[model samples]
Target: MTTDPAARSAPRSSARRRNLLLVSVLALVPWSVQTFTAGSATLLFPWGLVGPATGSVTTITDFFLRFTMGLPDYILVWPVGVACYLVALGSALSGVLFGREDVRLTAAGLLLAGVTQLEVARGFSVQPGRTAWPVGTVLLWAVAGFLYWSRAGERDAR
Candidate 1:
C-alpha cells in the first residue's frame, strides 16, 4: 500500500459512483411481483411499468397494478401513490449521491405507497409462494444499509 491518499481515494470515488449508479438503475427493477390465481402475474417496477408474470399467487395483479402501475386501463387510479413513490425514489437517489440518511425516507415512502395501494384495493387476496420476493426492494435496502454504515464508519475513523 502506498502512502498516497490520492491513490487510495481514487478507488473509493469510483466505488461510490458505481454504487450511486446502481441505486439509480435499481429504480428500473421490479420492486414487487403481483401474481393471480389464474396463473397470470405482473411486475411492479419503480419506474411505473407492469409486465406479465409467471409464478404462484402473491398479489392480485389487477389490484396491485391498478395502484402501482397505473396502466392505460387504470387511468383513473389513484395518483397519490405514484407521487409518493417518486418522492421516495428521489430521496433514495439523493441520499446515495449526496450521502444523506436514506433508509428512513425510503422505508416511510414505501410504507405509504403500500397503504395507498391497499386503500384502492377493495378486496383482494393471494398466497405468496416461495418465489414471491421483492428482489429490487431487498437489494436496494441492503446496499443502502451497507453504504450508510460504511460511509459513517469511514468518516468516524477519519
Candidate 2:
C-alpha cells in the first residue's frame, strides 16, 4: 500500500496546530490561587504574567503573605519554576514552527518540571488561615501529559 505524501503530512500539521493552540491557551489561564483572611489572589494568569503581577506562583503568593517556610523564603521564591515555564513555552512554540521532535519533547518535560516545582513550593507553605488552590498546576500537568504521551506515541510509531 502507498500513502499519499500530502495526506500524511496534513494530519501531522493539524496535530501540530492543535498543540500550539492548546499550549497558547493553557499558558494564559490562571495557574494558581489562594485566599487569605485579608483577600483572595489569583496568579500567573494572562494579565498577571504580562501585567502588573508578573512572577512565579511562589513569588505571587509571597506577595500576599510570607509562606512561613522552615528555610529562608528566598528558597521558595527562586525563579527555577519560572525559568522552566518560559523555556517550555518557547520550546513548544519553536517545535511546532520548525517541526523539531526534540524541542517538543523537551517542552513537555519542562512543563512538568515547572508545574511540579510550583506545586511543591505551594504545599510546603500552607498554613491554617489560607486556602490554597493549585488549579493552574493541576491543569498544566494535564496538558503536559497530553503533549508527552501524544508526541511520544508518534515518535515511537516511526
Candidate 3:
C-alpha cells in the first residue's frame, strides 16, 4: 500500500480543528453560567450596586461601578467571562480558517485569564468562600499557557 503526504496530514489537521472547537465550546460554559447568574446578589454574583437589577444592566453597572470605585472585592466576572468567550471564539475560528493557532489570540486569552484570576483572588480576600469558583478559570489559563510554551519550545527545537 502506498500513502500520499497530503492524505497523511489531512487526518491530523482535522483532529486539530476538532480539538480547537472542543476547547472553545468548553470555555464558553463558564461564560454562560456567569451571564445567567449575574443577577444574583447574595450568592456567586454578589457584586451589585443597587441590589442586582434585572437583565444585563446589573452586569454592566456592576463592572463600571467596581472599576471606578476602586472596589477590589467585586471582581467583574461578567466582563472576564466575555473576554474568555471572545478569545475562545477567536481561537476556534482562527484554527478553522487559518489551519494554525493564532498567537495573538492565545496571548489575549492568557492576559484576560491572568487578570481575572488576580481579580478573583482579590475578591477572595474579602469574601473568602464565595470567590473560589474562578480558580477553575485560572487553572484553565495556566494549562493553556503551558501548552503554548511547550509547543513553542518544540517548534524552536526544529
Q: What is the C-alpha lDDT of each candidate?
A: 0.53, 0.58, 0.52
2 versus 3: better TM-score goes to:
2
Q: Sort by lDDT, best first: what order? A: 2, 1, 3
Model 2: residue 9 alpha-carbon error in angstroms: 1.6
Best by lDDT: 2
Q: Model 2: how far is 13 from its true place, Å?
A: 1.3
Candidate 2: stretches off by over 4 Å = 46-78, 107-110, 113-128, 156-158
State the displacement of the C-alpha of residue 130, model 3, in Å, after optimal TM-score superposition.
4.0
Q: All candidates' TM-scores?
A: 0.51, 0.65, 0.52
| Candidate 2 per-residue lDDT over residues 9-49, each given as its tens digit | 77777777776776667656665555556664434442232
Backbone-clash count (model 3)? 0
lDDT of 3: 0.52
Model 1 segments beyond 4 Å from truth? 1-5, 53-133
Ranking according to TM-score, highest score first: 2, 3, 1
**Model 1 lDDT, full chain set:** 0.53
Candidate 1 structure quality by residue, lDDT tens digits, 3-122: 898897676666556555655565566655555656765665544446455343333344455444534322223356556656666766665467553545655555555445443332
Task: List ranges where model 3 is wrong by over 4 Å.
Answer: 1-8, 11-15, 28-73, 128-131
